[model samples]
Target: MSSRIPITLAGLAIVLSTASALYSAHALREQQQLVDHLNGQVARIQPYAFSRSDLDALLSRQSLAVAPPAAPEAPPAPMKRESAPIVGERRYGDATAQFSLIEYSDFECPYCKQYFAVPKAVVDSSRGNASVVFKHVPIHGEASRREAFAAECAAAQGGNDAFYRMAGAIFSSTAGNGTGTEKPLAVIASSIGLDGAALSRCIDNQEPLQKVKADFREAVELGIKETPTTIVRHNPSNRQVVLSGAKGPEDILRAMAKLVQGNGAAQ
Candidate 1:
C-alpha cells in the first residue's frame, strides 16, 4: 500500500509541472505580441516627428524677411456740384424735411420705370416743402435723345406736370428694345398729348438736346456709371450719399435716414 502511494504522488507532481509549462508558453507569446504592437506604433509616429533641420528648411523656403503690405488708403470723396436743379421743381419746407433724394435716370431704362412711384411719394409727402429734382440721362439710344428733348418740350408747353407724365410714359414703353427700331418719338409725343406737329418741328431742336447733353456731362463728372443711382442729400453739413443700382424705396429711405441723422435733421 505504501509503495503505491509514492507512485501516485509522483504522477500528480508531473501533471502539475506540465500545466505550468503550457501556461508559461502562452504568457511568453502574449508578451511578444505586445512588444510587436508597440514597435509598430513607434514606427507610425516616426514620420510625423520633424527635426531641427526640417524646421530650418521650412523657414528658409518661406524667407520670413518680407515687409507687410501698406494699409489701403480710403478713396477720395466725390465732389459735389453747385449747379442748378437740372430739371423738375424745388419746393419750400425743404430744410425741415426728412430727406433730399436725387434720381439719375434714363428715360429708356426699365429700372427707371420701376421707381416712378418713389419720386411722386417723396414730393407728395413733402407737400411743396422738400425738393425732388429729375435729371435726364439719355442712355437708351438715338430715340432716347429725342424723347428726352420731347419731355422738356412738353414742359415748355404745359409745365412740370405734363413733363413728368410724359417722362413716365416713355420709360414704361417697350419701344427701345434694341431691335433697331421703336415707336417713333413723334408717336410717343402725340400719345402724351403734345402737339404732334410741334413735336416734329422740335424733334431735332438743340435746346432740349443741349439740356440732356449737359446732364450727361455732369453725370460723367460725378462718376455716375450706372442708371437709377439715387443720391440723397439729407443735410447741408453732411456729405451727400450716393446709392448705386436700381435700389427700392426702403433702401433709399434707410440711406436718407442715415444722412438726416448725420446732418442733425429729424428722423
Candidate 2:
C-alpha cells in the first residue's frame, strides 16, 4: 500500500469515532430528562402536536377528576344491538337505546383502561336511552391477542356477561401499555365463575383469534389507528362523533349532548 493510504484510513477512523461519541452523548442527555424524552418522541412521530407540558397538564387534570367505580357484580351489558347486527360483539345497555358508543379498544392499552368508565356512566344515566359496544383491537402483541381471546372464551362459556366480566377484570388489573399473562387470565375467569378448564381449553385452541381479528379489520377500515377510539352516535339522525385518548366523563357527555341537541334543532 502507499504511505498516504495508512494516514487516510487513520483519519477516517478518528472521524467515525468522534461522531459515534457525540451521538452517545446526545442520546444520554436526552434519556436523562424524562420530559425531554417525551417531547422529542412526540415531536418526531406523534400527530397529537401537543408538547410534553400539554400532556402532563392533561394527566394532572385527569388525576384531579375523580372517577366512580363500576358495579361489583354487573354482567357484561349486551352487544350488536343496532339495526346492523354484529354476531359476536360484547355490549352493555339497551339494544334499542337511542344513543350508542362504540369503543375500539386493546386489552393491553392503558389509555383504554383509563377511559373505560366514562361512557358506562353515560349509558347508565341515559335511563335505557344509551348503550356501549366493545370491540377487540389487540394492538400490543401475542399477549394482547391472548387476553382478547380469553374474553371471547369467557363469552363462549357464559355469553356476553362473561365476556364483559373478563374484560373488566383485565382492564382493572392492567398495569400499563404491556402484555398480559396466563395466570391473571385464569384468575379473572375463575373469579368470574367461568369454568377454568374450559377457558384454558378455549384459549389453547385460539379459535377466538379470528373473531378478534374481524373487529380489528373493521377498525382499520374505519381509520381508527388508536386505542379507545370512541364513536358516539346520535342514532336518530345517524350522526357520529369521535373521541380518542382518556377523555373525561364531562367532556364526553357534553359532546354527546351537543350532538343530540344540534340534531334535534336541525330536525
Candidate 3:
C-alpha cells in the first residue's frame, strides 16, 4: 500500500508539470499573434507620415506663395507754354521796339509791388530796344480784381498813359496783401489826375471788367501761375524767355540780351 501510494504521488506530480507547460505554450502563441497584428498596423500607416524636414519645406513653400504690396505713384509735372503771350494795347516804351516784356502782374502781391518799376526801368534803359506789355493776373480776390478794372477804366477814359499812371498809383498807394489803399478808389483816381466821377461811372457800369477778364484769361492761357512773371519776347523772331518771380532790371536786361544774341539780330 505504501508503494502504491508513492507511485500515485509521482504520477500526479508529472501530470501537473505537463499541464503547466501546455498553458505556458498557449499564452506565448497568443502574445506572438498580438505583436504581429500591431506590426501590420504600423506598416499600413508608415506611407502617410511626414518627417520634420518635409513639414518645414511645406511651410516654407506656403510662405513663399503670398505676394507683397504695391508701391504708390508720383505727382504730375507743371504745364509749359506752347506759344508766346499776346502784347495788347496796354504797352510801355516804343511800340516798334524789337523786344516786348510781357509782364503778368497782381496788384495786391508784395512781390509784384517790388518788381513794379523793374519792367519800366528795363524799357527806359533799353533806349527803344525793349518794351513792356502789362497784363492782369489779379489772383488776390475782389480787391485786386477791382483795381485791375480801375486800371482798365483809366485806359478807357484817358488812353494807355492813364492806364500806366493808375497802375503805378495803385502799386504805390496799396498797403498790399489785398488791403488796398487807405483812400477810396475814386480818390486815388483823382490824385492821379483822372476824373474821379468818370472812373466811378466806368467801374459801376462794369465796362472795363471785360478787358480785365480778357487779360486774366490770356494770363491763364499763357500758363502764368504767380505774380511778376515776365515773358521776354523778340517780336521779329517770336522767340521768348520766361522770367519767373521778382526779377531785377539787370536780370531782365540780361535775359533780353540772351534772346537778342540767340536771334543774332541787331539790338
Point to the candidate with the largest lDDT. 3
Models sorted by lDDT, best on top: 3, 2, 1
lDDT of 2: 0.68
lDDT of 1: 0.57
lDDT of 3 at 192: 86
Candidate number that wins on lDDT, 2 or 3:
3
Q: Clashing residue pairs, candidate 3?
A: none
CA lDDT of 152 in candidate 1? 75
- Deviation from native of the Cα of residue 209 in model 3, angstroms: 1.5
Q: Can you write out model 1's per-residue Cα lDDT over 1-267, one digit (the tens) per residue?
A: 998999999999999999999999997786455445434433443231111111111111221122454665986565443222235442223546545576777666555666655655644544442356677666655555666777777676667767777776676665442221256656776787877566555544444655666666766678776666767775445456787666554554455445534533332
Encode model 3's per-residue lDDT on 1-267: one tens digit a residue.
Answer: 887998999999999999999999997776455345434433443232211111111111211111333544765454342222212479988989878999988788777887888789767766577788998877666678778878887887677898899999999888777787777788999998988877777765556655676777776667666667888888877788887778766566656656645543332
The C-alpha local distance difference test score for the whole of candidate 3 amounts to: 0.71
Cα lDDT for residue 245, candidate 3:
76
